[model samples]
Target: MKIAFYGSSLLSSYWNGAATYYRGILGELARHGHEITFYEPDAFDRQQHRDIDPPDWCRSVVYPATEEAMRSVLAEAGAADIVVKANGVGVFDRELLEGVIAQARPGALKIFWDVDAAATLDEMRADPAHPVRAALPDLDMVLTYGGGPPVVDAYRAFGAKLCEPVYNALDPATHHPVAPDAAFTADLAFLGNRLPDREARVEEFFLRPAASLPERRFLIGGNGWDSKPMPGNVRHLGHVYTHQHNAFNCTPLAVLNVARDSMANVGFSPATRVFEAAGAAACLITDAWEGIEQFLTPDTEVLVARDGQDVADHLAALTPERARAIGQAALARVKAQHTYALRGVQVDALLRAQMKGANA
Candidate 1:
């Protein structure tokens, strides 16, 4: 199948959290013998801070953030068998959402892939006139990265024809265990871009814990945290590039995964960092959320924390041997059942079945 995907930058993980998800899923799809063309607008300074060049797996087209350029790309995308308009392109999202469906050729499958389904659903609920809510009936299907049942039901309620959650998984070739680097060595580390919905959670789960455990070393790496106030024990390394993620995960004695406010409230929504940390064999401590067992067994494969106090207690009790055991268990579990190769096969089958049904 020839698929054209309109999304945030594929070559940069600068401010876009979905870059890894796109690379893992699309790269695997290409390996499955599907041709992919990724269209990303040159906005938000992402093009200036690209982590990787155009990859061999897909043809990446970076267009100017203009109406003319967007229309041109939409016209080219009409030739594809599948057209995907992923959420959070950071520029002209409304036009792309409606344009993809409008310009698609007869019999072509139109999909809206939501990387952050929980937040998108919240927006649609708050405003009945949301563009995505209006586009739901016209889209052939809706695929989400996470938010298991809640997201599915919410999209269906909005009149979507089909809805499914594709959940995040590890890409072994891209993220795996590496030798620890002194530059990133710390007791606990968190890597996430600062956003309105997530900043408070980060403060609760990460900042509070750091303040309580004054003796322990803490690290923060992401964009927009350089000016945030933090305890003396916490070190801020702003904007760790994609290339440094493996080292950042590997060196920390334990890594943290704090979901955004919407994701935590919706439950069953695991951020991409969860799998990335586990894939690198880093003992992971995540803020409490439902449906974690569906991906990793709690207390064995991962450590669940209810609040800052729980995080501090967990860190205090963690022994080097115990941490190593948990990390290994998580790594083994993900490798056995949660890899992008497996996810790619599942997606290919789903698309093929949908295509067959359309033809019939």
Candidate 2:
């Protein structure tokens, strides 16, 4: 199959959290003998901060963020067996959604791949005229990176023909255990781009815990967090690149996963970081959310925290040996059930089935 994927930057993880997810899924799809042409707009200084070059797995087209450029790309969609308009392209999203459907040849599958399904569903619910809401009925299917049953049901209610959650999984080749870097050594660390929806949760699960554990070192790595107030024990390393993530996870005694407000509320949406941390054998402490047991067994594979107090309590009781054991268990679980290889096979089967049904 030839897939034309329109998404945020695959070459940059600068402000695009979905970059790893795209690489994991699409790269594996390519390995499955599918041809992939990824279309990402050159916007938001992403081109200036690319983490990886275009890989052998896919043809990456970085087009100018202009109407003409968008039109040119949409014109090429007719050649693809599957045309995907992933959410959060950060430029001309509405036009791309409508245009992809318009440009796809008859019998070709058109999918709206939502990396942030919780937030997208909220938007659609609040405004019936949302572009995605309007596009749902026309789209052949809706594929989400994380949201489970709730998201699938919601998309179906909005007239989607099919909706499935393709949860985030580890790319072991890209994110595996590494020698600890002294610079990232900390009792606990949290890495995510600071955003409005997640800032408060970060304050609760990360900062507050840091404040409570004054003797323990805490690290924060991501963009736009330099100005945020933190406890004396917390070190802010703004914008750690993807290459350093393995060490960042390995060096820390434990890593924290704080979901955005919407994801936490929606339940079952695991951030990409969860799998990344697990793959690197980092003991993970995640904010309480639904469906965690579906991915990792709590208390053994992962540690769940209900609030800042729970995080502090977990940290206080954690021993180096205990952390290592938990980390190893999580790593084993993900390697067996959550690697991108497994996810790629699932996605390959789904796309092929859809194509067969369309022909029939």
Candidate 3:
């Protein structure tokens, strides 16, 4: 099928998780014989940070991100078998959304792929300025990345024709265990950008643990952490690229996961790192969150940490052999169920359903 993916930067991860998401899904879709044209709005230096170019796999169409570009793209978008518009394109996205709805062919599928369902819903509920408030019923379908039970029901309640959660999964080719890089090797590591809402949880789940275990080396990766002071043992690497993630995962004795406020509140939302770390055979020590058990069984596949003491205890109790065993078990689970290929199959099913409904 000829698919047109309209989204934010395809290359930059700057404050957005959608970039990694697009690379994984669209890259795998290309491998599956689906033709893809990815549109990127030239808002940031996406071309500079691009890890993968528009090889034989995809046609990359970058627009000027203005109203004129929106008009031009909507004309071309009408021809696609499927067209996807996700959140945060840095353009006049409301007008762009209107344009797409106005210009799409009757048979061409239109989907809103949300990387931030929780935040989007919250914004809509809180204020009147939100663009998606009355536009819920306009899109053909709503697709999300990480919100679990609550998000699906809420989107349906908000008048969506269909709402599906395409949770983050590991790309098998990219995220397997590798030998440790000396710099990333650590007793424990946490990687995520700093946000005001997630700060307290980071303190409760990460910083406090570092303070408790002063002798152990802890690494932190992600941008915007420079202002935060840390214990002497903690190493802050500003941002680790997608290519560096496997070593970052495999080299840690146990990787720590702390969710942002929306994810924690919505429940069952696992970040891409969770799957990546699992695929790299890294034993995970994650902060206690609802719906976590659905992904991994506690005390066997993963260690659950509700507080700093729990995190410290997890580290103290680990033996290298036991850690490797847990990592392997987690990795096995991801390979069996959560690979990108599995996700693509689900997406293809949804698209077929939309096409079927369109015909009927």
Model 2, residue 188: C-alpha shift (Å): 0.5
lDDT for 128 in candidate 3 is: 64
Candidate 3 — worst ten consecutive residues by lDDT sum?
46-55
Is candidate 2 or 3 superior in TM-score?
2
Q: Rank the models by TM-score, top first.
A: 2, 1, 3
User: Candidate 3 at residue 182, lDDT?
Assistant: 90
What TM-score, computed on C-alpha atoms, does each candidate reach?
0.99, 0.99, 0.94
> How does each model score on lDDT?
0.93, 0.95, 0.83
List the candidate 2 regions with Cα displacement exceeding 4 Å: none
The prediction achieving the highest lDDT against the true structure is 2
Model 2: worst 10 consecutive residues (lDDT sum): 146-155
Q: How close is candidate 3 to the true structure, as a TM-score?
A: 0.94
Order the numbered candidates by lDDT, best leading. 2, 1, 3
Q: Candidate 3 residues 217-262, lDDT tens each?
A: 9999987898899999999998777788899998889999998888
lDDT of 1: 0.93
Candidate 1 lDDT, 187-219, residue by residue in tens: 999999999999999999999999999999999
